[model samples]
Target: MDIGKQIKTLRLGKALTQTGMAEILGVSKSTMSNYERNISTPDPDTLRKIASYFDVTVDYLFNDMTDSPRDIIKEGTAYHPDKALNKDEWNAISYYRRLSDEQKDFIKGQMIQLYQKSSSSNKG
Candidate 1:
């Protein structure tokens, strides 16, 4: 696993500067640079600190996976690469994501009722 690359990716993903991360970790900028550049490796204590700061586990930091923030999808989100949604559908999704829990439940109930009505109409 490329630990240096993982650290660099996490730091850049958070939009944090090397100097800023260095100060946060109580290390020198050169040390941070070195860590990112694969010139030196941080001890276990520092690894824990970095993991905590990045909201990731130490194993993840040292793991072979190339993690990126953009690659992580939010929960309850739907993604269909084979089918593209229309603008109205996209807008509805955006609006739904911004709605409160109660509003979502209300909308869901309304949708279920609409679907039932449409089904009955078609049956007739």
Candidate 2:
């Protein structure tokens, strides 16, 4: 199960510090430290809250789920077997994730335009 490892993985995946996560959960920093270090287990309520906050099931936290949601989403996305997305692709993805809905649409439009240009060039 390794709940502590899963918690550490998820928290780090989300780029949240222990203090930040503790503040969100209304727990002391030491408590969060304890949970991540496997020194102490969080109560059921806290566990549920953590699961909810991370948008994962409680079973996932307790079970052996090796991949984080971010890893799953970004996996093989860039099409290079040796690695995931390259620096430019990674940068674009990271920035796109923070965009507003309208901005996202605009980016999609730009992508369509690029695709069209490439398609036309290929035909020529």
lDDT by residue for model 1 (25-67), tens: 9999999999998899998999999998776779878775553
Cα RMSD to native, each candidate? 8.9, 5.9
**What is the TM-score (0 to 1) of candidate 1?**
0.55
Q: Residues 56-111, candidate 2, lDDT per residue (tens digit)?
A: 77887887555423223434555333444444674566578678999999999999
TM-scores of the candidates in the order shown = 0.55, 0.55
lDDT of 1: 0.81
Error of 1 at 71 (Å): 9.6
> Which residue pairs in candidate 1 collide?
none
Please name the candidate that would achieve the greatest lDDT relative to the true structure.
1
Candidate 1 stretches with Cα past 4 Å from truth are: 67-124
Worst 10 residues of 1 by lDDT: 66-75
Which residue runs of candidate 2 sit more than 4 Å off their true CA positions?
Answer: 67-124
Each model's lDDT: 0.81, 0.79
